[model samples]
Target: MSLIITDECINCDVCEPECPNGAIYQGDEIYEIDPNKCTECVGHFDEPQCQQVCPVDCIPLDPNNVETKEQLMEKFVKLTAKS
Candidate 1:
């Protein structure tokens, strides 16, 4: 599943740089995760890097954008190809 940044985000700018897919961005209010670009760091790390660094623990799996691990890997491959 992809990750989502809730209203709890502090906009501390820590999570933005930790996202390997660059899915996290400065939204109008809080940091937003673009599901299209979010692989949950499957291609790059063992766990979601943003979640690890976020102080408020606002990052969570996006149930609305859920995907299987295999599906996430496929998306990661596609994203890697674009680079």
Candidate 2:
């Protein structure tokens, strides 16, 4: 599943840099995760890097954008191809 940054985010500016997929961005009130670009770091790391660095633990799995591991890998490949 992709991740989502909740209102609990402290805007510490830490998670943005940690996201390998560049899915995290500054929203009007908090950091937002773009589900389209999020791969949960499947191609880059065993775990989601954003979740690792967020101090407030505001980033969580997006139930609304859930995907399997294979699907996430496909997304990672597509994103890498664009880069």
Candidate 3:
């Protein structure tokens, strides 16, 4: 359920608005997602909106931060509870 952005990002800022969980952010030079906040859009959408709107398809699964659906739900819970 993890997600990440690759270097293929063009910095076009197209994918930022598509995020439902507010996980995507402009990186120092590329875009990055806070793994703790990314829920793969499980709670808010059927698919990862960021990837769907990305002009370059730079957003992809984060191999290093892989998580299960249960974990993704947990992350969503935590993120919503933080406020």
Best by lDDT: 1
Order the numbered candidates by lDDT, best leading. 1, 2, 3
Q: Candidate 3: lDDT of 63?
A: 93
The lDDT values for all models are 0.93, 0.92, 0.85
Worst lDDT run of 10 residues, candidate 2, spans: 51-60
Query: RMSD, each candidate, Å?
Result: 1.1, 1.1, 1.3
Which tens-of-lDDT digit does each residue in 2-83 have in candidate 2? 9899889999999999888889899998989999999999999999999898888888899899899999999999999955
The sequence of per-residue lDDT tens digits that candidate 1 reaches over residues 1-83 is: 89999988889999999988889899999999999999989979999999999999999999999899999999999998955
Error of 2 at 2 (Å): 0.4
Provide the lDDT at 26 for model 2.
90
Model 3 error, position 42 (Å): 0.8
In model 3, the Cα lDDT at residue 40 comes to 94
| Model 2 bad stretches (over 4 Å) | none
For model 3, how does the per-residue alpha-carbon lDDT over 1-83 read when each residue is reduced to its tens digit?
58989888889888777877788888899888989889999878888888888878888899999899989988878877855
**Model 1: CA > 4 A from native:** none
Error of 3 at 82 (Å): 6.8
lDDT of 1: 0.93
